[model samples]
Target: MKVLKPIYFLLALFLSFYPLCSRGEMSAGDYYIYADSVNTGGVISGGDYGVRGTFNESPIGFTTSTSYETRGGYQPMELGMKVSASSLSLGTLSATAIKTASADAIVWSDAGTGYTLSIGGVSGTSIANVSDGIITIGSEEYGLSVSGVDRAFTNDRAIAERLILASSSEPVTNSKTTLTFKASISDTSVGGSYSQAIVLTVSGNF
Candidate 1:
């Protein structure tokens, strides 16, 4: 009976460990599918991913004569511009001028005698819009109305106050636009060689 008791104890121990060995030998597929059901929670929302974008603008190539000879009459000068823009908001173009002297005195000490600079243009882009009337800048206002068409350009220090020569919300790639700057001087104006630096600015929103 003592020998039979030892044999029975060994049999019981083998039976207890048999189920554990079977569970450890489970296949990879069966273990993953049956082990706690892998709660994915649908899309697994988190801030680990994101979306982004970018924009670019090419230098506005302006071509024109370096000097102009205004012989006391309406002397018209022209410059051409080609714009390449990648933006979602409207692209804007403007020009502002600063004389060597003052606005009223293109030539020093010449009160009430100065040359007038005006800008105008026709857009090459079909969807682009140009100013149609005299756009005012600060206290000064100028007109670019010519030939029954009101293609005007405003002069101001503020970019918001400046005129929009050409604009469109869509991207403009190498769009050709012609800008005509007409300078008029009266015969009684100062005799010195007067000059003004005209600054052209272009911007696009993204």
Candidate 2:
């Protein structure tokens, strides 16, 4: 029997907004008050210090058993975020699988034959199609659909599309979300080492 080693990479990107306010000095006047002196502070001054967001983990790992072809298992990836902005938007998540030795390799091309990625265990915001692996939150697939690929990992071929992992109209602080990846081998799958990279990004709207 051949041994199969599959690696998964997780990367998170965060975008925050910080605004500064100017202070004005008022003097005693008749009807309307006029400011004799005004002081403008530079950006990154006099604002919320803890208004940024972060992820709990980096380069999240996943390992499959030797008998993954017969029996599949779940790889759980937990991610956390905190934002002080009035609104938040989660960007699309993408994945690209490549053979360790070969740049062009195809695993499971047939539909519903390779692997399925899903999202669950969310806090602070609501998500749709939690386990379906289809488009739900933004406008595209919520998770990756592992199908057989004949080319290298490129932007058009590697993207999962509109993941929309999480969002909020109000401020969300220290919230957690989990991604569950289930892998399996098809009849055409070869025995070797395989790996893939997953990227996720978060942005805020003030």
Which is the leading candidate under lDDT? 1
Candidate 2 Cα deviation (angstroms), residue 141: 14
Candidate 1 TM-score over all chains jointly:
0.26
1-206, model 2: which lDDT tens digit per residue?
Answer: 12322221111111112211223322233221222112321122123331122223332354356765322222222333332232222322322321111111111212222222222223331222224433332332222222222111112111344334334333333333333332333334344433334444443422
lDDT (Cα, tens digit) per residue for candidate 1, span 23-83: 4222342222112112211122224532222112121234335684333211122222332
Query: Which ranges in model 2 have alpha carbons more than 4 Å from their true place?
Result: 1-162
> Relative to the unseen true structure, what is the Cα RMSD of model 1?
25.4
Q: Tell me the deviation in Å of residue 46 in model 2.
A: 31
Q: Give the number of colliding residue pairs in candidate 2.
A: 2
Worst 10 residues of 1 by lDDT: 100-109
Deviation of model 1 at 64, angstroms: 39
lDDT of each: 0.30, 0.28
Q: Quote model 2's TM-score.
A: 0.26
